[model samples]
Target: MYTYVLFVHLVAAVMGLGAAFGFPIVAKSAKTVSQAKFVLNLLHKLEVLPKAGSILLLISGIVMGLLETWLFKEVWFIGSIVIYLAVQFIVAGMLPKNMKKQLAALEGVQGEELPEAYLVLGRQSAKLEGISHLAAFVLILLMVFKPF
Candidate 1:
């Protein structure tokens, strides 16, 4: 049962983080206003996978922690959970707002070139995304090494 839950957790992480890692790549591919709009729409739809994956990750992680109660007391586990929640806030809360602002900025633009506002928002979003990715990397390290 624990192994099965662990398997689900791993799968959720891959499905969620994989989709997330691909987002900037997809967004970067757009060369025109129309393409940018289309890409943003596509990204909005693609968000479902990560959202579902996050829920699964949370559930499976909690179940595993419950099953192995000692994990709840471990510093690495606690840190991982904290980092996960922080990443979730950035991913679920911050990123969407930034994307919406980007969309709004795009709405007023008249050319193939992305507007300065949109570009600024994109850079901000990219920074947030980078931070989330880094946090995820730290979570992986904590999970793998259980240092402390």
Candidate 2:
């Protein structure tokens, strides 16, 4: 039960991160509006992952740590989930809002070149990417170490 739950948790983390990865690819391509199709596809892929993988991962992980064993006594496992959730919250809040801003700008421009504001948003997105990637690494450590 422990190992199985761990496996599900890890897999969910992967899915969530992978979904977020679409933003960099999409945002980078946003500079070239003509090539936004690939980015759009990536965004579509990302949109589907969390709804599916997140639930499974959360359920299995909670079962293992909260109920199956006293794993919560371990700081690493607990910390990892906390960090993961925080990262998810930032991603959910930051990225989509940025995208929506860009989308609104697009509506104004009617699909013309991206504005200066959009570029600034893209730059900020790079920062978000770095933070989320680091969070993912910490989660990996928590899973492996399960440290108290």
TM-scores, one per candidate: 0.97, 0.80
Q: What TM-score would candidate 2 get against the native?
A: 0.80
**Per-candidate total of colliding backbone pairs:** 0, 0
Task: Please give, for residues 70-147, the per-residue lDDT of candidate 2 as tens digits.
Answer: 777777767867886798776667866766665554454556466676667667767888797787777767677766
Segments of candidate 2 deviating more than 4 angstroms: 37-45, 110-112
| Candidate 1 colliding pairs | none
Kindly list the per-residue Cα lDDT of model 1 for residues 31-50, writing each as its tens digit. Answer: 78899899999999999989
Error of 1 at 67 (Å): 0.4
What lDDT is reached at residue 1 by model 2?
A: 66
lDDT of 1: 0.92
Q: Name the lDDT value of residue 145 in candidate 1.
A: 91
Candidate 1, which ten residues in sequence have the lowest lDDT sum? 108-117
